[model samples]
Target: MDVQEAVFLALDLTGTFVFAVSGVLLAARRGFDITGGLVLGLMTGIGGGMIRDVLLDRVPNALGQPIYLAPPLIATLLIYLIGKHVSRARIWIVTFDAIGLAIFSVTGTTIALGAEANYPAALLMGALTACGGGLMRDAVASEDPAIFIGTDLYLIPALFGAGLTILAEVTGLLGGVVSLVIAAAAFGFRMLAWKLQWRVPQPMRQWSYRETGRRMKKLPSVFRKPD
Candidate 1:
């Protein structure tokens, strides 16, 4: 493989391990069995990339290559071995997840642009790749994914990372050193957001009386017209 391909593979492996650890921790919190934990871990590691590949019209590397699956399996085993002895599994999981998000955001943006996608589509792909695994994990665990809830700056870092990659590509600076710097900046922003408890405001809508009445009227259509 060429240098770029090698770098891509390395990033994929690192992201997979990070995501897998996050999933394993969630599984432990939910009291899942060992098999369930492994399944969840594997899903978390490969889920985002699978989505990105499907969108980009390519076969997911995670399925075609053993290297992609092996890291998560190893991570699952490690988490299992450590079990509860790890004093700060949650903190470590969050840290790794942020790093993975940063890496995958850049990777997704680069891949999308390499496939000749438009800037907007490439940015969307990066956001999806960065946040998709966490969304799936939250869904499986019966929790709302933070990305959708505006609970944190989860999507912001991904956007920044993708933007940087896109800018670099446009400026003819899509080199390894530039990409690494962009990824580091993205990860640093994420860490800062976490440390500062940065959150987007969730606006609550006030229901109009007319709107409430319309909803009330519609609700009785299948209940004998409410007598």
Candidate 2:
């Protein structure tokens, strides 16, 4: 493989490994058995890519090439062996998950672009590649998906990385250095959001007749009802 291809492969595998670690850690935190951990880890490692590949009408790398499965298996084994000594499993899970998020955001976009997808599709694919696995992991573990929770930044950073990748590719500025920068930017954004406890804005209250009335009263007389 060419240097660029090799780099992307490394980043992809790294993402898979980190995602697997996060999944296994979540299983451990939930007091799941080894079998549960293994399944969760594999889900988190390959689920997103599988989703992307299927959507793009290609066979999943993990399915077509058995080697793509190695990272998660190794990650599961390592965590099972050493997980008992690690405290704060949740923290590690979030951290490694962030790393995977960054990597997948970029690599996924690249894959979509390589597949000749348009810009919008590439952007969405990047996010799916970064988040599909986590969504599945949470569903399997019976936890709320962090992407939907909006407790801290999640989807935004993935989009940011994906957008940046698209911009770089379009501008002919994409390179190994640029790719790394994009991933770093994504990772930093996620970490900062976590550190600051940033959250996506939610509706202040459920929409209802009372809320409608209150809003109506706040409007200017011209815009309010004659009554």
Best by TM-score: 2
In candidate 1, which residue pairs get closer than 3 Å at backbone N, Cα or C atoms, i.e. clash? none
- Residues 1-227 of candidate 1: C-alpha lDDT, one tens digit per residue: 99977877787688788888888887887889777788888888889888988999988878778788887788788888887886776677678789888988898898889888999999999888888988888899897786876657899999999999999999999877787888899999998998888878664332354545444333445657555
RMSD of each: 4.2, 5.6
Model 2, span 133-156: residue lDDT tens: 999999999998889866678899
Off by over 4 Å in 1: 206-227
Q: Give the Å shift of residue 76 in candidate 1.
A: 0.3
TM-score of each: 0.86, 0.90
Model 2 clashes, total count: 0
lDDT of the structure predicted as candidate 1: 0.83
